[model samples]
Target: MKNQVTTIYKQAERFAEITKSAIVSGNIVRAKKCLALAERLFATGSYETKNAISNVYVFSVSTFMELRHCNISNLFPQSLKAEYLKQINTSGV
Candidate 1:
């Protein structure tokens, strides 16, 4: 279980990196997909794993919001942003 959690955390980290690159390259679709995958991986982890990857998770979420607000507001409609915001709030991240 420890190993699996660690692996999942690492995968989330990789996804976060890819997400950052995608956002930098202005590929909002790819960035959103990567963020979703990363979030799913984070959600599946154990408590320990989630704690270990909290920074990555926070970074990914923050980047997504930044992109949504600054660069790709059109790509992410208000409704979608609200949904993501709700997820962030409920997840207690």
Candidate 2:
């Protein structure tokens, strides 16, 4: 039981790390315009456009969808959101 608890804690820590990395490395604009653009692309973009975003961030379709869902989950607090927003805005994304 102790081992299981420790393993679960480690997994949660790793998940938090990955979540931080994802927020750091992507242009996470969850605004209406960005969502609309994403919606339009998913609706009608070419395969190449579907293949990559700015040729830097790439995820399998369902993986990206899951990522989006996780980002908007209650796990993302205002402080983290503010930090991520500041980061991307400063980087001029």
Candidate 3:
């Protein structure tokens, strides 16, 4: 379980990095896809792993929000939006 969580965390981090690169290249679709994969990986981890990846997730989401120009409210997945909202509420951001 620990190894699996660690693997997931590493994969999420890699996806987060890929997401940043995609955003820099102005590839919103690729960035969104990577962010979604990262979020799903984050969700599968244990509490400790989730906490460790929370910053990465937050960074990825905020970067996406800033780079995306379309109607993101409709385009963003509800699950990820909910997670973002929950993080904001909890962190008082």
Q: Please name the candidate that would achieve the greatest lDDT relative to the true structure.
A: 3
Candidate 2 on 1-93: residue-level lDDT in tens? 653534433443343344345455664544323434444543465665433322222222224446556544333334333433443456543
Q: Can you list the residue pairs that collide in candidate 1?
A: none
- lDDT tens digits, residues 1-93, model 3? 653534555655665677667767879798777656656656786786566457665556555666665344553566666666676568533
The ten-residue window of minimal lDDT in model 2 covers: 53-62
Q: Of the candidates numbered 2 and 3, which has the greater TM-score value?
A: 3
Candidate 1 lands at a TM-score of 0.48
lDDT of each: 0.58, 0.40, 0.62
TM-score ranking, best first:
3, 1, 2
**Runs in model 1 with CA error above 4 Å?**
1-13, 60-93
True-structure lDDT of candidate 2: 0.40
Best by TM-score: 3
